[model samples]
Target: MKKQTINQKIEIHASAEKVWQVMWNNDSYKKWAAAFMPGSHYVGDLKPGGRIQFLDPSNNGMESDVESVTKNQEVTFRHLFELEAGNAGKTLGDMREKFELVEKDDVTTLFVSSDMPEEYFEEMNTATTSALQIIKEMSEQ
Candidate 1:
């Protein structure tokens, strides 16, 4: 099992607080993470040691453990799921998705970083990319 790290960034016009609000708020999970939440936005907690669960009607949901969290700064977590029924697939290990906020005069940079297994690293990449795109559009909206 090889470990891999992934990094992605997106500069938004809104503040970090604004982005975080839309990103973690369980109520708006469907608005942002709609790719995962196909039917509706389920309940979840965005706290350290908290559980971030996403439920979909089509059996495409995941539950993870909130390993650590830094308010308005970053959130680290681990994802556990069975690749195949009765068989523990590959644990993504620990995924530390850090959202670093920095203001450059007018534009605010939202840098995202994650560390996970190679197979699941692509999942983070795709999800992060989609999330950032939705965020940018939502910010404009």
Candidate 2:
């Protein structure tokens, strides 16, 4: 399946470390991730070569490999397949997601880039915008 990359960004009035914490901290992750799906969360490790599951309340979502991680700077995931009933399903069209943070003068710019099937471009783009807003709010507060 052909995929298109969706890019979204937000500038937060906070340090990169603060933004990173808000984005990855378990509790905060759920709060912002709700933009995509209520009760959305992740399981497993977040280091390079680790496997992580991005799951919804019903145990359905994506299983991805942690492609790279640079504390306070960047993280990337290569989504391998979908999950249904906590089981791996079909391949997800070589989709990948990356988050990069750059700080200047105490403000952080968070950039999110993700690839998905063309059919989902709009939905994912909107979700990502909302999610980034949530992250910015949480980090600033």
Candidate 3:
């Protein structure tokens, strides 16, 4: 399947740390990620080389490796394969997701870039946009 990169960004009236927390913290993550899939969540570490699974309620999702992480500044995940019933399935076509946060005067600009299958581009784009709005609202609070 063909793949394309989708990028989304939002400015939050909060510090980079606050934005980061809202994006990665388990509780807040579920709220924003619900835009993609209901009961979505991640399991595993966030450091380089750590293995992570982004799963929905049925344990079906993507398995990835943390390519890099820099606390409140940046984080990247390289998707390896699709997870079916909590098991590794087909390869994910070199998909990757990255998040970058830039802060100035306590305001944080959060940028998200992800590689996804062409067929799902439009749907993912809308979901990402809604997810960012959720994150912005949570971070500001």
Candidate 4:
């Protein structure tokens, strides 16, 4: 079966740098990301080639490698595995997530795209929508 790619976007009336900060800063990230997993926060750096684990309060989460980072422009992460009960299970297929920012006329357009198996389409769609809404609110503040 072929996997699907989903794209979600929102325009924030803030600088790309500011949006990026709210999106990646651990505390702010946890707030918005709670839409997907309550108390979600990442445990790692945002530099390219670094390992990042997005975890919930119970520590259940997914681990990925930061494939690329371009400051306020873009960030790509490649899924490596899923952590459950403190055990890592190899990811069965390719799953790459990208966050891109385009600023024009003082408005920053943030786009989040992810590639994953079809089974996750709905869940991702809903989560991304909710997350982006929170991002919009935060950046507009």
The digit string of per-residue lDDT tens for model 3 on 17-110 reads 9988998999999999999999999999989889999999999999999999999999999999999999989898788999999999878999
What lDDT, from 0 to 1, does candidate 1 have? 0.65
By TM-score, the candidates rank as: 2, 3, 4, 1
Please identify model 1 stretches exceeding 4 Å from their true place.
35-42, 82-90, 104-106, 120-124
Q: Can you write out model 1's per-residue Cα lDDT over 1-141, one digit (the tens) per residue?
A: 576777888888876667677777665557777753456354457788887655565444456677777765677767665233233444555544556666666666777776666777677678778877887677655
1 against 3, candidate with superior lDDT: 3
- For candidate 4, the TM-score is 0.94
State every prediction's TM-score relative to the real structure: 0.71, 0.98, 0.97, 0.94
In model 3, which residue pairs have backbone atoms overlapping below 3 Å?
Answer: none
The root-mean-square deviation over C-alpha atoms between each candidate and the true structure, in angstroms, is 3.5, 0.7, 0.8, 1.3
- Runs in model 3 lying further than 4 Å from the true structure: none
Residue 131 of candidate 3: its Cα lDDT? 93
Could you give the candidate ranking by lDDT, starting with the highest?
Answer: 2, 3, 4, 1
- In order, what lDDT does every prediction score? 0.65, 0.94, 0.94, 0.89
| Weakest ten-residue segment in model 1 by summed lDDT | 81-90
